[model samples]
Target: MTPIGNLKPTIKIYDTTLRDGTQGEGVSLSADDKVKIALRLDKMGFHYIEGGWPGSNPKDMEFFDRIKKHQLKNAVITAFGSTCRPGVEPGQDANLKCLLDSGVKLATIFGKSWDFHVTKALNTTLEENLRMVEESVAFLKGNGLRVFFDAEHFFDGFKANEEYALAVLRAAVLGGAEAVILCDTNGGSMPFEIQQAVEQVAAELPGVELGIHAHNDSEMAVANSIMAVQAGVTQVQGTVNGLGERCGNANLCSIVPNLALKLGYTTIPRDNLSFLTELSRFVYEITNLNPVANQPFVGESAFAHKGGIHVSALMKEPGTYEHMDPASVGNVRRVLMSELSGLSNLLYKYKGLNLDKTSPEGRKVLEQLKKMEHKGYQFEAAEGSLELMLRKAMNGYREPFQLQSMRLILEVREQQPIHSEAVIKMRVGEEIVHTAAEGNGPVNALDNALRKALETIYPEVAALRLLDYKVRVLEEKAGTEAQVRVLIETGNGKETWGTVGVSTNIIEASWQALADSMAYGLLGEK
Candidate 1:
């Protein structure tokens, strides 16, 4: 039997990573970074990319000004802002004029849907809010603009006053909005409520195109969006990695693949969907935010497994545990080895290392890994290092360069009284290299010193920088005296990789991971 509305399902993806995504906590992309990311999104085939609020900030204005020269293919650049402020005519409002003059053919203007916001935030009555919505939308339409009206807090507004909410949407539709987007502004609505409200609105306004702009405060934005689609919405609005205000908007990374593969809805092209994971990571990297490991479909741990039973089952048939193949979303399955692993887990790791599972040497290596994991060595976070170690255990490994010794020294004094200095010395391939650097902190000093030492021998190492440095206390029994784990992410021009190190001394742990990152990069090239 054919599913209702499933035979010819269609969706339009509107990515607001540049606009709403920058509103996420601690996220601010420079104009150059914004343009670089925008080019990437356009190449990835997003239908619409919200460039930014043209008049809201200098960076956004600069981005639009700079992006005019490059011709974007397959994606329309959108300038986003609120409708003309209350008590002001659309033709005279600076914000509305700025959006129109930005040279962007597509524009998204949000208007107050909730009566509370209209009454309180705007300090205006319901009639004024309706006029603001209508006038702003009509002005943009008359100026040859494809406008999308974001009914901010639509669901909440509907619950508060159904007639007012319908009236707001009616204003947008009557004003010639290309799409009327229902925003779960507070992101507190559930899927059931979303379905009911969207169905009601669709039934009432059958002539208007519907869009869903949701947030993830309730952790149901993606689900709610899907429910809205089932209830007849055609456009989905979201950020690339669920980045936005508060708990963030729906994640386009998850939404695009879910609608395409699971629901069989056509939104982005099939070929473009395969780049979802890469694009998700790209945006996260540019924002200097770590990608959530557990995020659905595209995260690092989404396809990672460690349990013995699951590994055994997966070895025979991956469907035993996996909901979908990892490659379906441009990711690969990873078998993690730890204390909880059984022989099958060991075999899986062995196969990954390209070693014979039946070999005595392989068995010895597996036993060694189990013993090391028991001693607090985590292989999951140091997969590259673990692979190198496995090759060494099998006597098939070749060292790229031998480290003779490393010395790091730090000296500090208050500038008001005295000054300080730090130095690091290392012996690489029989040549002793020494370099000194100053930093505000001990870890920064150590990082600079070590990179200085390696740059002479490996010029390519200079292209890589430490993007992230994380520390975790493993054993805090003695309070200040405890073992810590350090994870470092390093990026060269082409790719980024993570390495881990653990020690009682934080400096030592950081150094170990830093060294491993450089070694892995050099060795992997061979």
Candidate 2:
């Protein structure tokens, strides 16, 4: 067994989100996006940014050409490519030449480690594959570039022919490779086997910097990665959301935090680990992937509490529901006030409203919230509406504006677009204001007319703007006549909040949400 000591405690993080990551299903990144992500990783103190294989395509080539424009602060930009093909000279290989021409100080090259691949995939002799690994490493190292030799399929190869797998690492080390990385290419190996493989590789390649690259087919990529570290591998390679081929690579977001907080290993400077949520979401957004809210550490739901039991317990002690403080990784705990919410959930959620949880008024707000939720008004996603109403129920709360009446006009003609206009009348203090406006839709028109009516009374209404609006059918089987829920997101220059409304008529639902959104924005008064 390895000593499991923190001899070289600072584990190097190599992000392949730009390369191996893009191979995952439904993921794509442009040249400019790659540079942007690299810069973010650099600022967050990642050690390696594997840009992409310059030899792969024009987009990747463009990424390499463009990344040079920015001076990355911490990350070493790495060009990725495979070793020279069988019977191809390293200096003459097109892929190898591209790695040298990528203009990066670091290059990671993967070579076949499985003899099965040597015979079946490459149709080359095992000895020739050895030459490919050796010559490619020596050629890149000779070109004044630090080489990280990735032994692709090393674990599968090691399990198949331990002697041949060990030979691959030996050949790369002999060729002056700076790092030897064992890859579980198919992502099929179990964690114990991974630890065993790392241990054997460590024994053979003594004193050499070792790395582990595992995929998540068996859902053990992060587990195997940390296990590899426990077995004394000094470096780990992964992607932000575990983006890669098949199941995906080890998730650096989970791996880094696990290493830093749980295992006592070092990665990404403990201070910068707080940026994990931002980094994870940035990647998800850039890739146009829906973020996994339940993803560990950085996910939105990572620290969210929903159950009354859980929230009540968390009110007394957070550790009951949360493994770690959400803020430690830049994630905020969300206590959603829904039908599932308890007194503790309501109290925690509306603590900003300053109401006593056990007070009659407080119980009224809780009952009100439960009633609204029963009516399909989801406060969990619309705390803005919940807060405005709860505050209005309390003493000293003044109405921002009271709607007296509203009128909407819709027009349709053959070969012409539908037109919508709204006129709103509201009582603001001692004055009654009336305004009219036109919009692209009923909701927009109503929003415009209401804002026009209030902006004159409360110029602060100008500070609020509609950010997003989403409408969901309460009962899809009710079809067009189904009751709808409108969740409107509004911003007051400083922050954003969500408001909710429910009604059988979509326009009415939108109107209620719009009114609450404006009320939330105005805060105290007209």
Candidate 3:
């Protein structure tokens, strides 16, 4: 901590997704991905975007070169590396040279703060390590670059030998580093340890700027970060979706909101907070990883309500169940329909419709919903299908097309292939259209036949795309004789919707979901 007298209201966000995040297993990014993420983070008002360690790989060096062609508005592209090697001049160290060549004005470099690391890992004297830290910062500063020093393993090192860790930071300050960030390199420090250590640093280095770079090995990274902020650090270093080497770094998704909404700290332009959910999902998408559904603030299930009592309270006032408005974080509140759902969930889902819980029709729909749920139909994942059921029961809605009859044939040839075909009859308006189609599978053949029969009557049916299909076994013990539920997702180039069906027969379940998907898409009901 440089002796900065008072902590500022605004906490700088130092994002290291392109660097630390990519270190996580199964996480990799192209140079183009880095640029896209950097630009988005800048637009969202992050204070710093760590491009990557240019000394480590070609893709990172390529990122530095490519990002220079475009100007960023808010975020400063910072390059990351370690302090000069033991006994080497900072000017000649390849690591330091890469930082200079990265063409970024700001650089963050780490050095061993724990004496054990200096003695055991670096195999160098503690005094030489301090000199390395100081000279590395001085060399980068002399080259006209702002430097932030990461005192690696500061927490554990401080606990082990308090005097030496503080000495490490003092060396960085003497070398003209702008900020000193305490790193929980091993990700095993307790929050109390972090607070006590950070407070000690703030008091000792009164005018210094301090930051915390926490890891989530103990599932306390987010908690430790907030505690550090409260303990007087003015900057938070984290990765989106908590992506990092092992357990992960602190999740900026959770940290930003906890600081801004709860602690009243300013971060990333308060209004831009609504983009938090989108930003979290975007990073997961770019990394080709599935989004965590129950992740805090930005997850799909974060604000979702399912229990009847919870939904009842939430319907009257969202604050009863939600800590904060979902829209504030670019997430929406979901009133899920399940066996546990009450009339309140139904009423909330049917808010715009002319339906009331007291009505006989409404009671019928609720009973029907419960019965379906008991039989393995999950309306929560197939709200489109649920909506259709409610419309038919409560609003006397008629189907766009009725299934008359269907037949299928499978030909098992000698050595070529097993071919499947479907013949279907559908009543569209006053005419009955019969069609036949072949497909690689029975379900696909049924889909093709259904489309061929209805496309002429409703051209939009041809544009409907089956985005995803999933099947779940209701009872594993029943195995071959078990009832199954099929869920289908359909898109119309604009939006997507889900439909579900259940049956003992896989083909029948698939057809039911497929037909419902088509009907839901054709009706264009939200």
Candidate 4:
């Protein structure tokens, strides 16, 4: 085996989330969003942030101009682009000129390293392609910007024509490129191929810095990246949450932890690793993408356990089921309660309630849990509702408000829109309040009326807002008469909680979920 001791102890993290990440389908960000994300990445200690291709669009150019106004503490903002065109000089090429004008200290430009791309894609001669790569780096370096050359398709090119691939990197180094990044552009290379190619490049290039940029088409991007690192790469270029074209780029979320925790390589500051999960979720939210619950390291279900034997073993010794402490990556271990749960799951879940598993009250709560789940209640997501049930059972909890009466009215006329209104009466302490509100739908009307009635007595309820509302048909075969389960996600700015209700009547089910959502939010205040 090649000696692993020669590998760089400190790896630099280069984030292209604002550029390559936006190439992923359905991922879009405003210049403001890019600046916000850059600030966060800088605060989190990323070494470099690739803003975008300033030559491609007005938005990216605007991003470059906007980002200059802010002071980033750690990361150097990088502008990305392609090398000079087939026949154009680096100083005259529009793309290269755009990079020069992007007002960033660093610039990364990708040039086709594969001989086939030069002959077919660019319809240019091999010598011209090599000149473009070299001259582009020279021009940028001469202009006071630090330059990094991306050898696009380097791995595949190396496999096809090893000599020419190495020559391309040699040209970049000769042009004073700070780093030559090897790219698996097609994302189809195996880990062993990556390691061998990267190692060969390191040997041939001697003291020149090397970086790795792997895509995830074959689901091997993360593996390929790690292999390259072992083969001698100091800089790792990736997008947060692995967002990129096609399948995606290598996920820094997974790569950083794997390097720091497993391989003993230092990437970001050790303390910054705990912000990984928060950063992952923030990206998903900004891009309007649903988070992958089971995604490794930073996902919601990454540390959740529900199996009885697993929970028993986990409670005894966390290492029996966990690889590392969840807190290490800013995540918490969750003991999920479900039909798959045993007494061990219950005891672990209800430990805060201070109830003995053998106690009558505990047994009753457990049976109620089972019965509710049998009726299509899913507590895993709606832990807020479960907490209310447990509190009522243990402490005789009373709700802040009790609904006395409700009325709904809907109207639809020819050539007019449908209108919905809700009237509600509720008791808060010794006061009986009445309120009416109109909305676009019955659920919205009810929510508005409820909020209007409770805000006077419990003004904190005004801060609560709906984040997500989902309905699942428990009995699909019953069609129109099916029992539907409604899950409502609510938040009070700081954090969010979920509540669920199931019934045959859709309206009743929605009411149940809505009321539980309100109840859960108020519970935090008391």
Candidate 5:
């Protein structure tokens, strides 16, 4: 059988999000969640998906058991665990035995490579640790499973005692380990250190398969992993969005694109490359975490252009500002509206919305946008509202709905079921709708009341949900009486859009944003 990543200089991607990503703060996945992620990773064409260590907990074991439903197309489902304990025979160790029992064809077992961990952490002699490594690899191989050995804390180990670390790798090599992974468990190693360590290992074992596992404590995990691959490693291990314990692990979202696109190494299929952004969002959705907007590859702001010069240059030649075409990775170039926006930026927006850029209307809209921005409206982050504004300024513009009035009541009373309620009056064409709803907050009550009034006329509004709300005081000198700007993010479980509003009252600001959010979605489809 051909070895995984056996093609000339092929770089195999090993995703450990199911295991390590769950360690991220506020991240918790059930057995079903783990299987769901493994299936998605398989769809992304990862070479290996390290599901989890079956022996660690019941959820991991259940993941191994349930992931079989997928019948994965491209990825090898790998079960992860540690080696047999000191003084325990491989077959007798429950953890080792559990890995084999999990019925996966590939297994990864992490073994201590640091002398300090061996003598102190495990309370065992160095020889016993080596014995544990060799015997565990040999035993797993004897069970007809391909095994990868993770040299835990290998970078620090190599720095502290190079000979012992080399011996550990040699032990795994002799024990029929298919690959030996050098891990920067502490995540503090620099790129140069990784380069030198990997160079020595590559020179010593020219034919052996090498991998790199890195953490992100010093924020060099992605850098160190790349350097290790450049030196000689063929396999890269990381969690999606860099989620892991503490500072997180190497960000696979960055590493894979660097290896496959920039460096010209085969990682995932060329066709699967575009799914990175969607895949990143998938993990974020399942984990219930807000994605870091500024993340390098799959972030919301990764390709967002805010500067006037940048928008101008990008409108002429995108490559002048962007490293690559955003569409190549399922991302799109975003021309943002801001105080920094130039005429070219407005022209870009005009073209995007099919407006006549040379017309007097375009000039008027652009001037209004700039003036409004100066008054605390940030269209860059609220394109939905910006688009609606542009559309309304056009010759054939049609208002989707007319707001009659809204009465917001906030009651602070003990033993009350709700704190706030809103009564909304709106007109759709000729029909007027009235509704009242209670909510946890005045903003929520307004949202509920507005939706209740609109949903019957525009059924699509039922799918919309308020995802996030953020407010900032625009006039800081006014203190509590300052004008507030509110940004409301809304989504329909499929796509998300942002809208903004500003007012002296917080509730009024929130209501404007919410009303604009619903109106924009309703009008855009028309």
Candidate 6:
């Protein structure tokens, strides 16, 4: 086995979620949310987390005030801001002073690396810009703070004026910066360019620690960060799920696993690796953002095999189709049963269900699965429901409860004095129950009524709620009479599961999926 770490080489993970991630369009996290996320990041072992620009926003300032009370074991919170203004002294600049008073042990300051930004944006000469970088860093360091100088637009600046770019880094070094971070502000540099530039800087500043800060405009932030590491950079800056301005920054979610598992770089403890996928999902949930299905390594589809040939090969040897065991990254290899499934795929899925694959009943169950999949049933997203259905098809599988019939009545009143109402009658097992509810919409009313009727016998079912519901029209030619497919995601306190239903009526489709979701949860329960 490869040694976990060589004396724990300090590969720092600098998270900028609160600072840069909030810059993404449609993302604005409150101070309370930022503090909660910061606590989680600290627990996950991020060495440094950039909380926010303290003086930039009232909310950020409040975050700093509130976060000071909590004790973070493994992380140091860093305050972020731009260097002092063109002509102002470092001690007099409000932004510089904000960093000093923020009570943070570390501070990161961004200075102009591109000559155009310096002369045009700041309206200052290149030499003055270098002076600002040097003086601001020295002032922060003099205040007993560990300073990191972010060379914004470094790659573009280097290509424009190599001498000036090197000079900016030299100024920070002379000013006592602990690390010189190269920023691809525009996020347009390719991996080759990033590698070359980083290598040159590392050579020039042999004693200084090098860091990489990249954005994903080219969908290459993760690639560029890895390239920088390969080029001898010691630190990586990123946000979880790549949440940041524009296309976003490099995703630490991807970078951590890539470095630890693939490149053999040491950072997080090996046992903690299993938490990678869980943490990725947790961040997405807290952010109220949908996790990308195809995101490398941790995504739901990252290790899922669908095609018949691929599934057949995977059954014999997973290495035939998979790069590595997905469990290494806290994900499991999945055989998705679909129209593309073959006998081997069916056998593997059957084995997963703990049924004898060679039995006659198992063969019948496999045939039924293929037949249902032909009718638009998808097992990949509704694994729980699929497992329940498989058990029902087996010889000795017993169901917890049976649905006899259900009827829904909706009454809409046009008169101002009258109120609309929805009533449901459901026969669960042998008990018949009736309930009435009012909701903003027909689906909500139906869902409420159904739950009310089932709540008596199965109080545990009340904990489930619909997280997402999607509808698709299967046949436009049928117009208003067309078949509809309903996909419903139901989550209890512990876990979430998805189920799908297809029928001519939209209400019926929803009801079918809702019933499947409930049945899946009740499966194997005594």
The most accurate candidate by lDDT is: 3
Residues 60-167 of candidate 3 have per-residue lDDT tens digits of 999999999998999999999999999899988999999999999999999999999999999999999999999999999999999999999999999999999999
Of the candidates numbered 1 and 5, which has the greater lDDT value?
5
Q: Write the per-residue lDDT of candidate 4 for residues 117-188, one digit (tens) a residue.
A: 889999999999989999989999999999999999999899889999899998899899999999999999
Q: Which candidate is the best by TM-score?
A: 3
Cα lDDT of model 1 overall? 0.84
Q: Which candidate model has the greater TM-score, 1 or 6? A: 6
Better of 1 and 5 by TM-score: 5
lDDT, candidate 6, residue 29? 89
State how far residue 42 of model 6 sits from its true place (Å).
Answer: 1.6
| Angstrom error at residue 28, model 6 | 1.5
lDDT of 6 at 33: 89
lDDT of 6 by residue, 237-264 (tens): 9998899999999999899988887777
Off by over 4 Å in 3: 1-8, 524-526
lDDT of 1 by residue, 245-329 (tens): 9999999888888888877788887877678889989988999998899888999999989998999899999999899888878
Output the TM-score of candidate 4. 0.90
Q: Kindly give the number of clashing pairs for every candidate.
A: 0, 0, 8, 0, 0, 0
Residue ranges of candidate 2 with Cα displaced over 4 Å: 1-8
Candidate 2 clashing pairs, residues 3+ apart or interchain? none
Model 4: lDDT to the true structure: 0.90
- Between prediction 4 and prediction 5, the one with superior TM-score is 4
Evaluated against the true structure, the overall lDDT of model 2 is 0.89
Assess candidate 1 and give its TM-score to the true structure: 0.81
Measured over all alpha carbons after superposition, the RMSD of each candidate to the real structure, in angstroms, is: 5.1, 2.6, 3.0, 3.4, 4.1, 3.3
TM-scores of all candidate predictions against the true structure: 0.81, 0.95, 0.96, 0.90, 0.87, 0.88
lDDT of each: 0.84, 0.89, 0.93, 0.90, 0.89, 0.84
